[model samples]
Structures are given as structure tokens and as C-alpha cells.
Target: MLMETPRLVGAFACLEYSFPFVTMARRWFVTATGIQVRRFVPNDEQGVSALILPIQREEFGIPITAEDQPDLKAIPTFYQIGTGDFWVAVQGDHVVGSIALKDIGSGQAALRKMFVAAPFRGKEFSIAARLLDRLIEESTRKGVTEVFLGTTDKFLAAHRFYEKHGFQEIAKEDLPASFPLIAVDSKFYVLGLNPE
Candidate 1:
């Protein structure tokens, strides 16, 4: 279910899956904060890269380039298959944030490419939350029972945000085999969509 209100709309949605054992639907939403989150389109790749690569390389001081990640060029094929999709946050004509879910078979997904610009990082913008809200909202609709993610240990704030949003810290060995592993990933998390 998706809930929206007016232009610069308020949004909420809940998605449900059966394979994880006919679980209850979980609802999440984003308040209208003047940031528009939408599905990835052909034209958005450059903007998406412009938003993410710098965050990975400069903000986080990670040693990588756009070529290091093929998904940056093959968004449609890599992230937009089955229940998976990528989303971007637009402020004016520029892309400021991103989040993506990759259907990794079974009832699981790998959350990837979540990044937000420095200016948009906190409660004032909630850009990260908006991108995540969009991803989770779609995950339930596609019947994904659990969402997993990998992050670097350097992202202390990101760790807190993920924990605050219900993702429990998990060991690398505990992640699903299909969950895409990143060389830089030193931390992992999982959010169960169904009740235990």
C-alpha cells in the first residue's frame, strides 16, 4: 500500500510476501520534505553516479572509481530485475541521494548503493530515510522476506541509522550466499520483514 498527499507528496507504503510464511505487512513512510524519490530512469544514471561515486571515494575516503562497480553503468540489468529496483532523490534537477534493492533469489534482497549528499545527511533533509523508505516500501510489494546490506566500518553514523531503522548487526558468515559482497564491506546487517 502507498500513501501520498498532494504535490511534494507525503508517502507511505506496505508490501507483503508469502514465501517467508504469510507474514504481516510492515508499513513505512516519508514525510513531505521537498525531496522527491522516484524510480531509476535511463537518464538518471549519470546523476546517480555523480551522487554516489564521490560519496564512496571522497566523503568516505574509499579507494574506488565508477568503473570499479559495473552496476553503476548497468543499473537496469543489475538492480532492476524481479522485485528489485533503484531509486534516486531529486532536489531541483540534480540527483542528491540513492538506494537500491537487488533480488538475490529466494526471499532475500541485497540493499546497495545507498548514499546521500553531505548537505542532505540529517533530519533536516532525511534524504537517506526517504531513499530507504522507498526501497522497503517496494520490497514488501515484491514479497521479499528479508533485506540485507553491507557497509564499511568507517560509516559509524550509517551503522546507527541502520540500527535505528531495525536492521540488526550480523556477521558476514550469516549473510545469504547470494548477498553481494563488497571488498570494502566490513559490517553487515539484516532486517526481517516477517515476525519471528
Candidate 2:
């Protein structure tokens, strides 16, 4: 008989991963949440964008002019070339979160724009951790040596999350005018994906 437990303190939406090939998908199955890690696809654009946009607005206090176009461009630049890629966290029919590995050469990739929806933010769901795990696996598959990411000073929660995932703070720098926000405060993180 299945037991119904009390509401988990921070239970977020459930993530289920399905891959076309059983073998490839099995290799990256995370037992903790049973989220099977897989490669991102073109159809994930809208779901992934929805998961990330509000966080961007909150962090930078700016708006995305055209959501579909920006995400659409990334399909060819990041996912298609095989140099970099991303993975999405899906539960039922809805996408809860996503993380991308941006190849920056020298066997290095950057973990960019990870976000879980407001309704599903916390440790119990393990969204961030699981996504990073999948990203590291993808980097290893693509022969990437290391990954780096940049965050703003305003995102203390994100900084903490990165730290928990073994990302170390290396530097802080100015934000280019091209970025949506006019703020100059930004922080950088470096993480070695290879296990010791």
C-alpha cells in the first residue's frame, strides 16, 4: 500500500524526465527526484522562457522586449551547434525550470539563466541542484572542461544556491550598458565539473 505523507515543508512541483533512448536517459537518472536528465529541444522554448522571465525582471528590474525571439535565437546559437546546450525540468505538461550550459571555449562552459517558478522555489524540490547535475553531465558528454556563471549583487539567494552547488565566487565587475539594467554591480562564479 502507498502511504500518503504530510505536505513536505517545501514540496514544489514534481519533475519527470523522458528521453527517446532508454540507455542514454538511464545514464543520467537522478534517484533523489527521479528526474531523468535529457537534452533540450526546440519545443521547450515557451516553457523555459516562462520559467525564467519573472526572475530576470525581479533581478534586473527590466522587461524582455520580445520573449519568443530571444529564446528562438538561442536554439541555433546554443543548442544546435553542439558546442553548448540546456536542459529543462518538466512536471506533467508544464515546465518548472531550466538550466543552460553555454560553451565559452577552452573546455569551459557557463551555467546561464537558471530559474524555477515562484510557486516552486525551495530545497525540497531540488530544482537547481538537479538541473546543475544534468548540466555537468552534458558538459562531460560534450568534453567541456569547466563552467562559469555571472550573477548580480542583488541576487543573494542565487549566490547562496551557486555556493551550495560548489560554485566559487571569483570576481565582481561592471555591467555593460547593453545589459537591460543600468547597474554596474555584478559577480562571477567558477566551478569545475570534473569530480575529484
Identify the leading candidate in terms of TM-score. Answer: 1
- Candidate 2 lands at a TM-score of 0.68
Summarize candidate 1's per-residue lDDT along 32-100 as a digit string, tens digits: 355789998989987787667666765678998777899989999999999899999986555678999
lDDT of 1: 0.79
Q: Model 1 shows how many backbone clashes?
A: 3
Quantify all predictions' global Cα lDDT against the true fold.
0.79, 0.59
lDDT of 2 at 68: 32
- Quote the positional error of residue 17 for candidate 1 in Å: 43
Task: List candidate 2 segments past 4 Å from native.
Answer: 1-37, 58-60, 67-72, 172-185
Model 2, residue 103: distance off in Å is: 1.2
Per-residue lDDT of candidate 2, residues 4-120 (tens digit): 111122333222222343311111222235443455677877656645655566445655433333644475465545557877777554566777776666676667667766445
